[model samples]
Target: MIDSFLTSYKIILASNSPRRKQFLTDLKIPFEVKTANIDEVYPDHLVKGEITDYLAKLKAAPLEKDLKDNQILITSDTIVWHNDTALGKPVNEAEAFSMLSNLSGTNHQVISSVCLTTKKQQLVESVTTEVTFKDLTPEEINYYIANYQPFDKAGAYGIQEWIGYIGITSIAGSYNNVVGLPTAKFYELLKKLV
Candidate 1:
């Protein structure tokens, strides 16, 4: 269904996330993964969606000059906003544990933004999902960390993994956003352009 919308254009997914790649593949959208190594740093003043939006747009920048008239490039970024701070990918076990501990028994916003660029148009949109986790004990967090090794994931957890199976009590918005990308919202955006 989605492929029909992009029949005339080549879709390029510019992200390293396996989940994001899988989501687009499951949608049966014909796209090729093309990633660029860019500094993920952003200004301190940017908050939540602003931060992700900026990064998503930034990820698209390097690909701008290479876009052909029939090629559309998609870039995205995800951040876990808890207690007014953004929790990015943990650098080590200690940091991951610290992040998980802070998220225990609390509600945090998972913000994901997607930027789409074509030769003639650019569009960016974001979705936020509020996720609530049950209070996780040290034993459980440790076990998950040891078993799953969520070092590459933001928020020190993956919603589709063991932690999500046992820890997440509820979510207020798109589940896919928590996983990584907001597929429904993204589909709507693509539909509009086609």
Candidate 2:
């Protein structure tokens, strides 16, 4: 459905995440992989969607001058918010354990922001998914941390992994948003922009 609109445009995905790559690919949209080293830090006062939006736009800022007239650059950021705090990727196993412990048997928000930019204009939006986790045992948490090594994932966990399979009790929004990108919303926005 999007192929017709995107026929003359070049799509560039500026992320190292395989999931985001696969999501775009699965949409039958051809794109190239491009990444830039952007600091993901946001202002200390930013919260929830603000933080994700800032980070997503930050990731795209470096590519502004590189954009061609007919090329679209996509950038995204995902974070887990629990108890009014944002949980980013874990720095170590200890932090992973602590994050999981705090998330066990709790409801949290997974917020993902996506930015689509061209040389002429920029569009940014975010999706928030509410995830409820069942009470996780110590053994379960340990097994997941040791096996999955979720250091690269926000909130120290991946919802598509074993931990998600066993720990998630309910979710109130897009599962893909929790994974990394909100595919439906992304496609919808692309349709409008294309």
Candidate 3:
């Protein structure tokens, strides 16, 4: 399907995320990774998807001037929203523990935004997945923090890791969205853009 839509276009993924790289590889769409040092900051007034959407677009801004006629650039951002607040990647061990403790026995939304840019046009879209967690004991949380060191993941967890295996109770949307990318929506948009 991608071959039909993406023919003759050079696809570029402007992110350092292994999950995003793997997603494109899994789709058999050839792409190159080119990331810029962009500050992932958004205004306090931006809410929910706006935050991620803005960041995703921010990531692609550096590559806009460098894009060739047929080159397509993709950038993305994922954040966890719990209790009307966004839980970004933990800055330290204590923060990771606190974030996990807060997420325990509760439901949260994982929102991922993707920006697709070309010289002629740009598109930004996002997906939200609801994830519920089983009540986690302090020992379990400690064990995960000590072993997994989830400082790089939003909500201090990875849905494909050991913590997810035991802590997650259920999910209401795309599991891949929680992992980092929403492959279904990503593919649909890629098909249209390519």
State TM-scores per candidate.
Answer: 0.97, 0.98, 0.97
Candidate 2 lDDT over residue span 5-60, tens digit each: 78989999999998899898888899999999977889999999999999999999
Residues 1-194, candidate 3, lDDT per residue (tens digit)? 66866778999999888888998898888999998997789999988889899999999998889999989999889999998898899999899989999999999999999888999998889999999999999899999989988888989999999999998999999999999988888887877875
Minimum summed lDDT over a 10-residue window in model 2 is located at: 185-194
RMSD of 3: 1.0
By TM-score, how accurate is candidate 3? 0.97
* CA lDDT, candidate 1, residue 139: 98
How high is the CA lDDT of each candidate model?
0.93, 0.93, 0.91
Clashes of 3: 0
Runs in model 2 deviating more than 4 A are none
Arranged by lDDT with the best first, the candidates are: 2, 1, 3
Candidates, ranked, TM-score = 2, 1, 3
Best by TM-score: 2
How big is the RMSD of model 1? Answer: 1.0
Q: TM-score of the candidate numbered 1?
A: 0.97
Task: Report how far residue 51 has shifted in candidate 2, in Å.
Answer: 0.5
